[model samples]
Target: MDVLIVGAGPTGLTLGIDLARRGVDALVVERAEALFPGSRGKGIQPRTQEVFEDLGVLDAIRAAGGPYPVRAIWKDGERIGEQPMFEPVEADESAPYTEPLMVPQWRTQEVLYARLVELGGRVAFGHELTGLEQDAEGVSARFADGSAVRARYAVAADGGRSAVRRALGVAMTGETVDPSPFLVADLRMTGLDREYWHTFPRPDGTGLALCPLAGTDDFQLAGKFPEGTEFDLSLDGVRRLVAAYTHLDAEDVTELRWASDFRPRAALADRFRVGRVFLAGDAAHVHSPAGGQGLNTSVQDAYNLGWKLGAVLKDGAPEPLLDTYEEERRPNAAAMLGLSTGVHRGEVQRGKATVQLGLGYPESALSEDRRAAPAGVRAGDRAPDGRVDGVRLFDAFRGPHWTLLGAPAAAAGVHALPAAPKSYGPGVFLVRPDGYVGWAGDSAEGLGAYLARAGVR
Candidate 1:
């Protein structure tokens, strides 16, 4: 195989979809018997929605999710006031998804797994990686069930406590963002209105939030425990927690589908690449689920690494192309860790930073803007969505191919299409397969040479 992806969560599944669409031989393996059942990482940011759109899962995702509702505060069983869950932003032609979508993480995984299968990708359930070894030629993984697979590259997306990451001897340096232990449960409940995310706050810096999970009758209940408190993970435990924090009785929480407890912490791997083995998703960087950056950033990690792997394995690109994955993603992950931590500490609100629309690789080696004075969009920026002639910019940039806007040079392998969009200003924009402008110049004077350096032509 070309790539062996550990952990069949959103990160691995997304990478599977990206690689399968590129006709690369990749396999995703999950330690669990099925997809995650919890509504963890439920908020899908706008930028990740764009990625889902490109991967052909946006329709299903949109159908399965809804926008975040207002947060309804409660005190002494009386409704206080409502506040916007996320700072609202108007949608524009350049960015269609201005707000984050609230879908259960399980549903997002289902959609991604389905799309991956549709694109001829395969995932092995109950395949736990017990050992991993990598050499110059390829990587070999051994599973707990006495099974093994070898591939040219391996990725660890198994999560924060990733065994693959541990096997690689990588250190994750981090600190606990909050000392309080948190409990999150997905349960069907009564007596609570589904229109808002109900929150009950205590003066001790602990609180409970019951958010109605979109497309399902269940609500995700998140509760913070006092220091040194030992919480249970049962149906009755969820009932007790809700009743203790709110006016609702223990019986109000009718059912508990799934529940988990954790301490919010932010951690990043010391290194993203370990020879032929690479780390992605929570394995690479674990974020406090505050700004909704954990899952979104993890999915984009796969998105950033997918094209590079495909290029080296299938497009005859140099091995050094793979190096850019760490170079680009590690720093971005670090920034997101800070953002997530800031949101956790209430130092930042869920607004433009949470939406993650402005993330780009302006300093990447593959990014270059030769213009003396760039007009609108510059290299290493996200290729905006707009109409150039009759073709939508996003539509033109979709698929596993590079796109050229405003420049009709047929000399390179990139598809030169219609005029540049107004959002992109006036310049020849060479968009990468992953929807970032790789090169922007006045014309196609050095287009071929730039493409050659990236091994795209």
Candidate 2:
């Protein structure tokens, strides 16, 4: 196989879809018997929505979720004024998705998994990775069920307590973002309006919040408890907690679907890659669920690595292109880690920074800028979506091939589309498969050489 992705969460399944669409041979393996049943990471950022658009699942995702509702602050069982959960930003052509969408993490994974399968990708469930060994050529992964598979490269999307990362002897260095433990659960309950996210504070300084999960008859319950507090994960416990915190009876919570508890943390792997095996998702960096950056960052990690893997395995690109994955993603993940921690500590608000539209690889070695007079859009910036001449920029860039925008009509060996919008200025821009500008120049003088150096002919 070309790539073996361990863990069938959003990261692995997304990578699977990208690889399948690129016609790369890849397989996703999950240790659990099925998809995760919890709604751990619920917020899908705007940038991730763009990724869904490129992956051909945007309509399904949009149909499966809704915008986050205004948060209704509660005190002593009284309804207070409603405040927006996230800062509002009007959708523009450059950034079509200006707000975060609320969907259960399980639904997101299901959507991604279905897309992967539809693209002719295979997923091996109940296959747990026990050990992994890599040579100069390929990787050999041994599963706990006495099964083994060999692949050109492997990714560890197995999550924060990653067994693959542990086997590779990679260390994760981070501090605890919050010492207070928190509980999250998906429950079926009444006595609450779905129009608002309800919050109930405790006298001890910890609090409980419940948000009606979009496209489902369920509310996700989240609560922070004092240190050393022993929380229950049973239906009775859930009902009791709800009754104690809010103006509802214990019977208000009718059902308990899933429950989990954890202390908030922010950690990044010592390295994203170890030889032929790479770490993505929680395996690469574990973030607090405060700013809703953890899962989105993980999906972007898969997006960043998928194209490079496809380029190397299917496009005859040099192997060194794989090195840029860690080079470009680690620092970004580190910055996101800080952002998540800041949100958890109340130092940052959920605003444009959390939207992640501005995230790019300006300092990446793969980015080439040869413009004598640079303008608004430069190399390493995200190629915004717009209409150019008679073609849509995103429509032109939907496929696996690279796109050359605003270049002369005579430029050879590149998909030279119509000139971009005024936002990008008048220059030749070579958009990478991952939708970032790889090379930008006033003309095609140094464009061909840059593409050749980056293994794009």
Candidate 3:
């Protein structure tokens, strides 16, 4: 296989879809017997929506989710004032998606997995990695079931407690964002309307909130506990906690679908790549759920790495092209970790930064801007949505191919959008397969060299 993905969550499944679409042989393995069965990581930010669109799962994702609702503060068994959960952002031509969508993490994974299978990809459930060894050429992974598989490269998407990362001896440095224990669960209940997210704050620092999960008859219940408290995850314990905190009776929680508890924390892997092994998703970084950055950052990690791997494995790009993965993503992950921690501590609001539409790699080795008077979009920026000669920029960039805008001459192996978008000003821009501008110039002066280095014939 070209790649061995050691998880089947959103990260690994997304990488599987990208690689499969590029005709790269990749396999996703998950220790769990099935997809994740909870509503964890339920917020899909706008940037991730663009990724899903490119992967051809946006329609299904939209059908399975809805916009976040306003927060309804409550006290003394009565509804209080309503407040917007996120700062408002208007959709424009440059950014069509402005808000996060609420899709249960499990449902998101389902959509990604289905797309992967549609692209002729496969996931091996029950295959737990017990050992991983990498040499100069490839990586070999041994499973708990005594089976093994070898591939040119391996990605650790197995999550925060990733066995693959542990086997690779990668250290994670982090700090506790919140010392207090927290609990979250998906359940069916009564007494609360499904329109607003009901939050009940108490005199003490402890509180509980029930937010109706979109596209399902379930509400996600989250509660905070005092430090050193041993919170219970059982259904009865959840009922008692809810009854004590709010006006509803314990029986109001009719069905408990899933439950889990943890203390919010932020951590980043010391390194993203170890020879032939690369870490992606929660395996690389763990974040506090605030600002909803964890899963989105993880998915983007797979997106940034997917095309580079495809270039190397399928298009004969140089091996050094893969090194940019760490150089570009590790810093981005660290920034997001800080943002997540900030949101958790109420230091930052969930607005433009949280949407993540402005993320790009302006300082990477691949980004080359030869234009003397660069303006509008530059090298390493995301190619925005616009129209050039009646062709939608996003439509031109949809497939597993590089897009060249304002090309003065024919490039051998790139989709050419001859006319430049009016919003982009005037320049020749070479957009990478991952949708970031790799090179920009006035008249294709340095374009050939950039393309040659990126393995674009």
Q: Pick by lDDT: which candidate is best?
A: 3
Instruction: Give one clash count per candidate, in the order shown.
Output: 0, 0, 0
lDDT per residue for candidate 2 within 365-402, as digits (tens), equals: 99988988899898999999888886888888886768
Deviating ranges (above 4 Å) for candidate 1: 409-413
Whole-model lDDT, candidate 2? 0.90
**What is candidate 2's TM-score against the reference?**
0.98
The digit string of per-residue lDDT tens for model 1 on 61-111 reads 999989888999999999999999777788989999888999999999999
List model 3 lDDT by residue over 23-101, tens digit each.
Answer: 9999999999999999999999999999899999999999999999999999999987999999999998878888999
Model 1's TM-score against the true structure: 0.98
Q: Give Cα-based local distance difference scores for all models.
A: 0.91, 0.90, 0.92
Per-residue error for 66 in candidate 1, Å, reads: 0.7
Q: Which stretches of candidate 2 lie over 4 Å from their true place?
A: 408-413
Between candidates 2 and 3, name the one with more favorable lDDT.
3
